[model samples]
Target: MNYIQGQTALDEEEKEGLLISTITTRAELDEFEQLNIESAIEWTLHKKLKKEQLLSESFVKKLHQKMYGNIWKWAGKFRKSEKNIGVNYYLISTTLKILLEDCLFWIDNKVYEPEVIAIRLKHRLVSIHCFPNGNGRHSRLMADLNRIDPLIAFAQS
Candidate 1:
C-alpha cells in the first residue's frame, strides 16, 4: 500500500474490515471511500433532519454508516481498540455523550455564532474520533449538517 505522507495506515485487523477485498492500494481505497462519502452527502442534503436529531448519538452513528457502509463493515461502529490518536476505546461513549450535550447547550444558549459552533463541534468530533475510520470526513459532514441552514442562507444572500 503506497500511503501518502500523514495518512493513517490501517493495521491488519482494521484492514480486515474492508468490504472490498480486491482493493490493494491507498488510491483505490480512497477512491472507493470518496464515492461512498459522496453518496452519504447527497443523502444528508435530502433528509429533513431537525437540529436535535443531527446532534444526537444515534444520528452520528447513522451518518457514519451512511458515509462508509458500502466499503467498510465497521463503518458506523466505534473502534474496539486504542489507536494512535483519540480517547481510549472505553471512553468513547461517555465522552461523545458529553460532547453532544455540550454542543446542544451551546446552541440553546447562543454560546457562539453558527460558524463558531460548527467549528467547535467539528474539532471536538474529530478529536473524539468516534468511528473506526473516516473520523475526519464524518466530523466535517456533521459540522456542515449542523450549520446547514446558515450555510444555505449565506449562499442565498
Candidate 2:
C-alpha cells in the first residue's frame, strides 16, 4: 500500500504485499470463508478437495458465491454490469471456472502434486485481479481448500 510520488524524489514504491497484508500477496486471499476451510484441513500439503460435494454445478456456484459474494457486492452479485471494466468482470468469473476445472482435473487424474496445484492456483488468482476488492483473500482460501489452515475457518462463511 506504500506509494511514492514520481518527481523530485519519488517513483520507486513497490507495493509491499499484493493485498493489505505483508506476507500475503494479491493471489493469496480471495474469500473470508477460505481461512476456516483451510484451518479444518491443517498444514498438510496433501489436503484433498471435496469431490462429492463439488459434483453439482449448483453446489459449486453456491460455494463460490458464499466464498466471494462480497466481490459482487462492490457492484452486482451475479449478472454483468456495463459500468465495470471488461477485464475485472472476465477475471472474476473466468478465474473461478479455472479454479474448479484445474483442481478437479489435477486431483481426479492424480498426476499433479498438491503443492503444484496450490501454487499455480494462488499465482494465477492474483494475476487475474478479479473483484474490485477481496480478490487476494479469496484466492488464498480457494487455493488452500483442502489444507489444514487457521485461515480456512476465517475464510468460510
Task: Using lDDT, give the best candidate's number.
Answer: 1
For candidate 2, what is the TM-score?
A: 0.44
Query: How do the residues 12-109 of candidate 1 rate in per-residue lDDT, one tens digit apiece?
Result: 78788889989988789889999999999999878886567878889999999999998988889998887777899889999999998987787777
lDDT of each: 0.83, 0.44
RMSD of each: 3.1, 11.2
Provide the clashing-pair count of each candidate structure. 0, 32
Candidate 2 stretches with Cα past 4 Å from truth are 1-49, 52-72, 75-95, 148-157
**Which ten contiguous residues of candidate 2 have the minimum total lDDT?**
7-16
In TM-score terms, which candidate is top?
1
What TM-score does each of the candidates earn? Answer: 0.91, 0.44
Q: Candidate 1 — worst ten consecutive residues by lDDT sum?
A: 148-157
Cα lDDT tens digits for candidate 2, 26-145:
234334335534543343234333553442234434444554443233321322322122245545576556665765666566545666766676677555544443344545755665
Candidate 1, superposed: residue stretches over 4 Å from native: 150-157
